[model samples]
Target: MGRLHSLRPAMTSTDLIVPDPVFRRVPAAFGLRWWMAGWRSFMQAPLPWLGLAVALLVLLWLLAELPMGGLLSQWLSLPLLAFGVIFAALLRKRAEQARAMTPQGMPVEPQNEGTLSSTTQRWTGRIGPLLLVSLLVLALGGVIGAVIVMGLGAMFGLGLASFGAFAKVMTPGVGMAAGLGALAGSLMTLLLLVLLALYLFSVAFWFVNTLVALGGVSPWNAVKLSVRAGFTNLAPITLFTVLLLPISIVAMLPFGLGLLVLFPVLSGASFASYHDVFGDEAAA
Candidate 1:
């Protein structure tokens, strides 16, 4: 197994503001390639990768069993989960760099690896900002959802009132207006919910975690760049989603235990996708 090591320079206290990142237009099939790369990375150090995934799952499960723990878990898990995956990717990257630097066919000695204390400190430093960004994103989603609900309610009210007026002319007290209004309201509510979900998902598709963890971008800037990059390469993003759907389902089976393997693969895939989109020049 490869030893864990700090692949990049230590993060600074000063926040870094990266420029708008450029993205490459990859073929739709690259989605599969990303998954393959992730799987390979996981295989290289299965024990550590799987151990991390299992630990996360156990923590989440325990949290979920407590009263109100589900809510607490939801909020806390985002950064913790992100930290593990991104950290693993960082270690994998460092290993790759070390290999590349070695002379051709020369024996590479075991070197100093990143300690747990350093990893925890680095991740803890970033988690606060990442959590804040997540909260802001949630707030945005709530606002969008509220607006859609209100607009739909207003439309339903107006439509019903107009229909009632017309019906009164034909026959007073038929009383079908209320029923029709309720039905329309329900349908509109469902539609609005769907729209809100799609909007939030679009926001997440951008590589925000990678921007923050690897690129050293401030949270807000990472969000902006991620969203921009996602939209700029919408086709590839769509293809990746479509390709991932079935794989995700399969990973959820086996009593959800498959995640031990799948999670690291996903982490690796995320790193690959980020690298593909923003090449070496984009690193902050």
Candidate 2:
């Protein structure tokens, strides 16, 4: 009787305490709902889109200059980059303004308006200096990262070549078997590259999440939390990414014109994803 009673309670406890399903990372996604919300929000205040457009155009123009070089190219690219900064500052101001005018019709906080306006002024006041500073910093970081990745790739290639030679000697009887093995090894290497890409993307997303979560604490703290939550909820992130893949391919079909809509939606959804995970703490 005692054994049966103990087993009944154990069964009841097991029934009561359900284990969380590993695959259910994302809250029930309503892609249409998220897309509609993102569209409405972006359309209501398109300054952020405008800013991104300006940045993209400037980047394209600069890249074009490389092929169509000369004094004119240099003159044009330099000025466009400068103007892109002004547009960014303006866009930031408009974004702040839009945030203040929330749909709730709740009384907009006076302090919020004041702080936003102050930030706007500061951004506009020293746009040139800040842009130059940012450009130099980004260039340096890009160069260093590129060098490191290139070095790693060279080392990997050298190792693969050595392996190919060893495989040829060890399996001489199996004609072309060594070559097939090398090809398979190359495929495995490619898979590793893809994994690395995902890791880098995860890191980048965490960084952006931290940047967007400005205030309340240091960016480092935000980064730590973002990375932790992202890994914890990888299932949803993976699902969303898979869903986006087809959309991205379609967007690229029309010479990237669809990107204007697709890009903003993705950006807003990223913000939404963060909001879903961290709630108001991230919203701030």
Candidate 3:
């Protein structure tokens, strides 16, 4: 429930890389912990997540109440929201888990399998706080993201309209020339804007991961760190973005059922990446 952090600086070139202990080790780059993190996160506090998801889906369903709204309208949003929530939760959890895995002065062991009563207590104990924290952050973030996407959509529509107006008054001989020129110009501008926004968002995403990993920070500070880290590690982070973009698109092919698996793996990898980069302070 608390933010985790490292008192020491990141590992330097002279720092040694030691093998991870068996329980701490991740296999195949991403592992079960990542997947489990997502699954467990949902299991830990499903009602609130489900409520948020259902509310979002219902909003979408109402908006789509027109003729075009079909089974896909009523149901598709539910799954999509679920998929996105699970993915985000996994990322958050992996970041936490990665922090816990850090070899701090206090060595920590994985929680052992126990009876249902004790396990239930362990799970529910943090569920309340975790749900409160995750819901607040996610709600605010979701609203901001939705606003950006909607604003972009409006801008694109306006640009198209402006081009139509320009085409309406052009000379016949010059019309073709001007229309093509306008279309090309508008398209290029839109593309540039989208790319720039995406770059900034990715950076912000990384900062959030960092803050979540490093305990005790507020959401605003997390955003600041993510922005800084994104700028500092632009190269590899961009490389990661390029590599993952296609995979993310492909995962969306099956109407997002593939996300059940893909979400967890990527979530785990994000956590693993954090672990690899900054030694987790939560391990203790």
Candidate 4:
């Protein structure tokens, strides 16, 4: 009883101190390692991981069946799915910690029968904050997207207006050249805006879910920290994004069924990447 009591404080104390995230400069190949690590973690408890993934898929499918379901799924299902995967990763991480503490020859203690129920309760309790953070991120992304669209619209309008003014005074060949130049400029502007939006959306909330799940950090603080960490490690992050693009497309190709495996693997990879970049101070 005394030994058990002594261990309890150590477990609880880890959760109390929220350390500032640390960014690391990893090799481009580290992205592949992160994906592999995710696969190993999923294999550690495949059934439970798959069950969670399937539940999320079902929930998303049901949401998609509703009116304007595509948007609804984005707004509602994304946060819920994120919460579930992060929570599962947290549980797996905790289990890993517990096993590490067990003696080499001795068997680890069995998990309590109430563990699943308790975890579910805890997940439900914390979901409000997760959902709030998700919505806030979405709102921020929307604002940035709108600003980009409006700016592009203004640029395109200006280009067209200038082309119109010049066309009246110019020969037919000169007018054609001016119109093509304007068209090319407008297309470039649109592409640049699209890339900018993707970059902002990716970095803004990359680590928010993990921080919230594992560190118990507030949503706002998590966002601030995530953005800072993301920018600090932009090269590695860009590599990761580039590498993940094809895997993501492949995951969607199989009637979206590949997501059953790829989704959890991606979640695991995110968790692994978070650990690598930020260091697991809370787990330490």
Each candidate's number of clashing pairs is 0, 0, 6, 0
lDDT per residue for candidate 2 within 15-110, as digits (tens), equals 554221111134545344445545643564466555565565666657666755443343343323323222222333345555556666664331
| Local distance difference test values of all predictions, in order | 0.68, 0.47, 0.48, 0.68
> Candidate 1, 213: how far from true, in Å?
1.7
| Lowest lDDT block of 10, candidate 3 | 18-27
lDDT of 1: 0.68
Candidate 1, residue 198: lDDT: 81
lDDT by residue (1-284, candidate 1, tens digit) is 23333334435667463365676666767777787878876766677777788888889889999999976786677676666656555656565666867998996532326633455666776776768766655666578768877877787677667776766675444546554666677678768767656854664545877776666666788778777777766666666677777878998889977888888887777777777777765442
How far out, in Å, is residue 211 in model 4?
1.2
What TM-score fits each model? 0.73, 0.52, 0.47, 0.78
How well is each residue in 1-284 modelled by candidate 3, as lDDT tens digits?
24433222223358565232111222332333334444554444444445444555466757687666653353333223323333343334444555578787864333322222332333333333333334444555568768877987898788778877877898776876887787788779878877887676655555343233222234454455555655655555565666667767886899864544554444334544444333344211
Error of 2 at 198 (Å): 3.2
Candidate 4 clashing pairs, residues 3+ apart or interchain: none
The TM-score between candidate 2 and the true structure equals 0.52
Among these predictions, the greatest TM-score belongs to: 4
